[model samples]
Target: MISDTLIPDTSMTETNTDKDHIKATMKDAILKAAEKVFSDYGFEGASFRAISELCGAKRALILYHFKSKDALWKAVAEDVKTRFLTQFSAYYHEAELKTDLQKSRQLNVAFLKAARDVPEYGRIILHEGLTPNERIKWMSQELKPELVTMPDLQDPFLIEASLSGLIRHMQAGALLYLGSMGPLIAMDTEDADTLLSDASIEQFADYFQAITLARMDQLKQLEEMQKEQVEE
Candidate 1:
């Protein structure tokens, strides 16, 4: 006689799904708490114990989601990056942004909004730049490569200069602006997303955009000059 076949358990399936959801929820909570802890303490300074406590999660549970402190830190960074990208994407493809300046301005505003949405963002950025370390390198190269961009140029010197100017203007301005007139805007305010403010941040943002656009135009002009030279 054949042995009785085991019947499928619907309750067991529901239980598994619930466990998966809880794991996801805990992971999100862990990342949220980790962002603050890492931003306040920096990578070397942040500890898993503090992160677990801040999220009100068990240390072992957090570790079950993220095996190492570095992994946890990266998860927090990824979470912030995801939020930034979500906001950035809104302006990245605006139908009415006819020029690069317009696009950049909108993108910059998105940056400000992202900073406000995630207040820990600016401090984390500042911490990353205080030294030439792996964290910043990972961010620049892997986590969010599109954070920096420039128009086509083949010259090594021009490329370096453009990259430097981008950092000094766009990226640097983002951090500075958020720290300066930034705190004034209520994260929940209706006007927080108006893209310009009375704090003169529009001028600050505009100046940086102009510097970057001028550099881009200069690079494009050189490309034209090279083409003309080839014809001659």
Candidate 2:
């Protein structure tokens, strides 16, 4: 038989643990829903009610978990950055490649895959790029310290902005421009959804890879010519 003091302590501990689990679960749900809503609608357009509804939780619960929409958006951005870095790390460890160029290609492929897997990330990033809000500034500042350690992301800003822009344009261009640019790619307005399809993304990735390789080769040749001129 346990002492009376021991019983209350054990019960309190169990209750606290359960509350923590519930809070974490609710936070995860809120973040998942927030990602979709924030991606579809920019920060100003996103609503706490809509996020709560999507997550099937009360607005009060969302408020309890995240204080405000600004806090929620920041949390979402941090979560995305964490996941992106994790995916990059995993891919870097698994890829056994020969040259820096080859590794760069692999890194791009990994980035594309990660973007496709979490397309919201691209949308959020593009929206931030356009809006230039405090949240965006905060995220950029937070990532700056770690940028030097990421060799694969040598030009992190350019690489990320390029990839995110490509993904966002492919996914949301129709809404922005009434599909005016679709004809250029032989794609009709009705086929906009296909842009996010796995087959289409793979094809696009291949095309991008070829173009990048060609550009790299051209740069190498130009450098060789410059070296020859210097020697002469």
Candidate 3:
């Protein structure tokens, strides 16, 4: 009988104040604080009190939204997924057909452009992927079912693995771009093409393109061999 009423018994005069449409100010405040703190210190060095102080919230309020430091870290990981993975996955998937080494130059450039445009993306990836953490593992397993399972539908795990490695290599250079070559690259500028035109930025992108193309050729050979076996 208790299970029959899933809806709250609020009267008609009572307004529903806790709708999902309501912006979670508390959560956002805490998340923003956590991002700054975590970015500066990494997860191990970042403290709840530091985040709470940065957020201008009591420690209890921070804990109330996040439950525990681990939960907060998980939230940050999810934040990275929402911020970076959603867009990068789409762009990378769309850029797949532009596999020519020349055309992929633009994709490589675009990757750098996106990192600049979305600065948090660089920090989040470095922290979550490059660094080791259970929170990273948990969020990765929870969030990336589509990316991981995609190899099943695509039937080319090798291609995807090679691509993953290439992307990681590009992202590894992102911080350096921000620190040293940022002004010349004009990373703060909005133009993608201009920033990519710098001659010094050539090596990683060129190497990635070459390696990826070679991997593709290998995959094609494997496919042809499988077809021959089937015909035989």
Candidate 4:
């Protein structure tokens, strides 16, 4: 019969808990570093070595956490999706939006904040839009069904296109090509940096919401005019 108190159950539990905490920390660090690298260099351009360098972790450790680059990309995409949904859900419930347009604006605001909070999300999306694959399809499958059910998001395609296109273009102009376009836009390095600041993102979100609502109102007016003509 072995002595059960040799190491003590409490000691064993503490050791296991420490290991679990370390593993979780390392995994989180790797995911964060991978997001920055993937955003800078799309899926094809990103490398495990680059991510390891960024996180100051060994390549073997990263591989241990995530089997391969594809697996890592999938993980990051899932994280982005989760963050967006979580933020939107929280804001929707907390805000208690009354009308469809109000809900739309609130959701849009939540999305912009999520994109800003997760810097890699927009870059990853732009990359997917340029070179779509099964991953993109998977993302669409995950998001589209939920999006279509929203009262203000019934026409998911049009809303997605309009919002994504705006974000992509703004990201490219403000972040990706800032070095080149900064001078032309009369923006110094500091000014360019401000483009991605929280205040700027909020401003952009408000502008986007206003334009979207205005467009919807215009469409409604046009439809009513067409109905009048038909009745006449």
Candidate 5:
């Protein structure tokens, strides 16, 4: 007995679209607020109430988007990962990377920009590093594998010089240098708000890439000599 006019109209579709857009916007805001909170206080010290206040959203809304604190933390981690990979590919081709050393250097450069772009990712890592927990385990599984590295090799004397996992260690340095900028906002720095300005990023990248390449070359030579002695 229903009339044909009873069917859904464009008005209803438009309303639904508007609601979806609002939901996405609210969620993104919550995530942005959470990134700052978690980066500052870390997972243990971070809370929904703080994120809610920071985002100006109700606590209930944050809960609706992320069921628990753990869920929210994991979501943030995933978001950071997506942002990094997205930025890394924004310019060049990954396939174009030739040597493992070159790939590692490029990755460090990429991380420099990625961390500078968001900065929260680097801060989160430093904070998380201070405390080992289930989160780190999850990261090792979900996040660490996203990047490539050289072969499995190490020498105690050449740990900092070796290409094997060089990206990992350099990232630690990068995190300290790049991640600590948020706190440095209070201390007067050049004209810009942070050292992550476009020109500064390029200059720092050039310096890091050059030094890292030299150290890796030295370590490679030492490794070759060790191999020669073993053969003799």
Candidate 6:
């Protein structure tokens, strides 16, 4: 018999524990709709009406449920936080994060695989996380103690911002590029599809990993130079 604790668990019990299942369902719908809308149009471009129209729920109901647009965005952000924890945290926990380069490469691959279907997640991340919004702040607080096993980041917050930006841009660009030109590019291709395919995705991971390792090396060199100057 397999032990339950050792098994990788992705199950959510549908019990009426904290929030009513109905309310949870409604909130999830709103948040999903908001994700699509916000992804297509940024935070400033998305509105309660747009989300409500997509959800097929009354706009007033959206307000009654979440209070306002910013509140809805906050809820969206909270949902994003939970999603990241549930989706990618396990892999990070599973990996050996001895160095930033290794961790960045591992995390990039993990996040790309986890997010292939949920491309809207990339959009949601880009919308608020381009400048370290509250969601990212919460993520920093949550992920650091767990996955960031490194002693000190190259300015932890700045590192987080850079990583997030790189992931968001690559994810969005890959989806857009492949969706438009994937067929044409892969017509006489050697192996497989362009961006959406697993091979292409892995290629992206490799590219981004190289970029991240280079950046880390540059930061280390800068730190060493500063130390030499201080000693002089």
Q: What TM-score against the true fold does each predicted structure earn?
A: 0.67, 0.64, 0.57, 0.65, 0.71, 0.57
The candidate that wins on lDDT is: 5
Locate the minimum summed-lDDT window of 10 residues in model 6.
1-10
Q: Alpha-carbon error at 95 in model 4, in Å?
A: 4.0
List, residue by residue over 33-100, the lDDT tens digit for candidate 4. 88878877888889888887767667888889998888998888778667756765665566777665
Candidate 3 clashing pairs, residues 3+ apart or interchain: none
lDDT tens readout by residue for model 5, 91-182: 32443666655554565566677777767777777788787788888876776644423323243423455435555676677678766753
Question: What global local distance difference test value does model 6 have?
Answer: 0.61
What lDDT is reached at residue 183 by model 5? 43
Clashing pairs in 4: none
Cα lDDT of all candidates, in order? 0.65, 0.60, 0.58, 0.63, 0.68, 0.61
Q: Candidate 1: how many backbone clashes? A: 0
Residue 207's lDDT within candidate 1 is 69
lDDT score, residue 3, model 3? 23
Displacement of the residue 139 alpha carbon in candidate 1, Å: 1.4
Score residue 126 of candidate 5 by CA lDDT: 76
Clashes of each: 0, 0, 0, 0, 0, 0
List residue ranges in candidate 2 displaced over 4 A.
Answer: 1-14, 91-93, 142-202, 221-232
Runs in model 3 deviating more than 4 A are: 1-23, 89-110, 128-133, 139-204, 214-232
Which scores greater on lDDT, model 4 or model 5?
A: 5
Better of 5 and 6 by lDDT: 5
Assess candidate 5 and give its lDDT.
0.68
Best by the TM-score measure: 5
Question: lDDT score of model 2?
Answer: 0.60
Tell me the tens digit of each residue's lDDT in model 1 across 1-232. Answer: 1111211222455576777776676677777778878888889888878876666677887888899888888888877777767765664554366654565565555565555566566677777778888898887665444543453345454466556666335666667556545546645455555534524555665666677667767778887999999999
RMSD to truth, every model:
9.8, 9.2, 9.9, 8.4, 8.3, 9.5
